[model samples]
Target: MSLAQRWREARPPVAGVHLDSGACSRQSLAAIDAAVQHARHEGEVGAYVAAEAAAPALDAGRAAVGALTGLAGSDVVFTTGANHALDLLLTAWPGERTIACLPGEFGPNLAIMAGNGFAVRPLPVDDAGRLDVEGAARSLAADRPALVHLTPLASHRGLVQPLAAMSEVCADLDLPLVVDAAQALGHMDCATAPAAIFGASRKWIAGPRGVGFLAVRPDLAQRLQPRLPPPQWPTALSVLQRLEHGEANIAARLGFSVALGEHLAAGPALVRERLAEVGRMTRTAVADLPGWRVVEPVDEPSAITTLVPTGGADPETVRKRLIADHGIVTTYAGVERAPFEMTSPVLRVTPHVDATDEDVARFVDALAAVSA
Candidate 1:
């Protein structure tokens, strides 16, 4: 069966609403199914698919990500996840290096750098969640950072960072800009400039879990060392290495290609426009709801929506209520802040290409009921 047909067959029946693509995208089920099928067929199933196939489905998946991200096929490397990609990328980063990130950047990245012994610095962001480019440049200059990390769209806040501008700053400083495009990939046009772009298949591209790619500029690839080398060191890099070498994701790669093909058949411009329309509708519906404020900008490139509840409602409490009482699924962002709790508690909602207008309405209505 075709990827879409496979998707239709495999997708689970779920209830009221869904809005947590940052954690995972329901859209990726088709690609995952395809990957699983191909993996099973090749006897390349399990973690060592990297070693079994000369050109594994996982490699194909990495290549597909490179195509989507505007990188050369050879520039892409597969990782366990976006977080694994981040850790691998920063593993060898020079010492005392300052990495600039948005205040509301994904929390795990900060923890990774801290654990790895890099100094982390927060850049200023406007209310809409765009990074202050000038400020970022100044910080980079002051710190003489060895590497700079950014999330094109802040997963927690649903904000789109100005990638081209940030790329320019990194270019000026001769620094490598590592973009966490986990949320931006499929939803936005990628920059063609040289940089390290990491993304997960589980989010916007709607692929499978345990799959992600890191695209390094062709020139940079030679300079960086592989975090995990294949068993046959000099002979050839494993499937992961071949992925780093630019092998395509056979099954999911085909599925991702199919997904992008569908997006193109629908027209990426049209897909983006539809997402924006749904986002606007969701924002409008939530505007009048009591004690709920939309934190992310309405015009951001991503389809994620972040809501902050007023009136002392705990985010976890509301999230559980939405799931249990209303059949609506959502995500909470305040779980990590223990010592000094973050004042702005956020709940995320994500809309996919497959999501319907009725889905949006049902989700909003669920939110209204939960808030009430």
Candidate 2:
């Protein structure tokens, strides 16, 4: 059986047509079971004792994340989630307070920067909301922001920022770059690292919520100073170990490890191809819907597609109707979710590898019916 079919069998049946993987994916059976089992173990063994025994599983989780992101096992440490990870990275950075990012940066991430007193500068973006790599390079060189941040796959839009080129620019200028891969993790061959790629496991990895990872370069990690001191391993001492301290959700980490293993077994490249195909099919299905506009370019990056209504029909309303009436799921993309104002309100439609052509067609038909 195909990986998608297998995954679907392992996961809970979709409540409706689940096209909201961009928001959060349903966890697989193995992940769910692992979590439940760990929780049970903790209940029996006592939390701290169970946690201490979970060392192998935790190490294995780190190794799994390393395999996915092309980092050493020592480079990754589980965090509460992407927001926590981002906050930790930013808090620890003892550099200039100027951070360069696209105007369409994730809302919470932008808030974290501003909250932490960083001068968040905007890097130019094209009409499609993609980063202007040349301008960014120039800005980085001329202004020398404390660091560069990119969300390879942004939350509110379908545009995939040019990471390879941006990374190249950062490399040439010897600048530090951090990637928020919350939406890109399981969809892409995230093998490019040395840049901190932090994300939640629930989004694309199909892992349980409350767990995410921060995989950073050794030098950058070395410079990091976690706000909270290590609650558990006060003496273990490496930057990652220090970061990994404090009581953690052992169950969630084990579940995340299983989710990562599932991805590795299928291979990242194959998963990317399957998801992109489904995305293109979905885009094509809805491209000609009268009065609706597709926001992504012809050549899209990830599996996310955003559609906007030309009429005054609210995207949020349509999203609700899709789920309530037609059993079709989608996400409303509002300006508030972005750092800057969105030109047009949109609905984010993201499908996973398990989605079939029939599923895409069903979603488009549902969309048209609801919009009508």
lDDT of each prediction vs. the true structure?
A: 0.66, 0.84
Instruction: Please give, for residues 1-372, the per-residue lDDT of candidate 1 as tens digits.
Output: 433344334456544566666677674455556666666766755534633553554455555566666786667766656887778767744345577777766777778878878876677766555788998888778777667887777666666668888888889889878888877776766654547888777776666666676787866655555544543466555433643443335555445544544444445565566566656666766776787888755665567777888866777888999889877777888745211224566787776655666777787777777776
Q: Residue-wise lDDT of candidate 2 within 240-303, one digit each (tens)?
A: 7767778788899999988988888888888888887777787888888886888776557578
* Pairs of colliding residues, candidate 1: 19-350, 28-206, 57-250, 59-247, 59-248, 59-249, 60-248, 60-249, 61-249
Q: What is every candidate's alpha-carbon RMSD to the true fold?
A: 4.5, 2.1
Per-prediction TM-score: 0.82, 0.95
**Candidate 2's C-alpha lDDT?**
0.84
Q: Compared to the true structure, candidate 2 yields what TM-score?
A: 0.95
Backbone clashes, each candidate: 9, 0
Model 1 TM-score relative to the real fold: 0.82
- Residue 38 of model 1 has an lDDT of 67
- The regions of model 1 sitting more than 4 angstroms off are 1-15, 28-32, 42-60, 94-96, 127-129, 227-267, 335-342
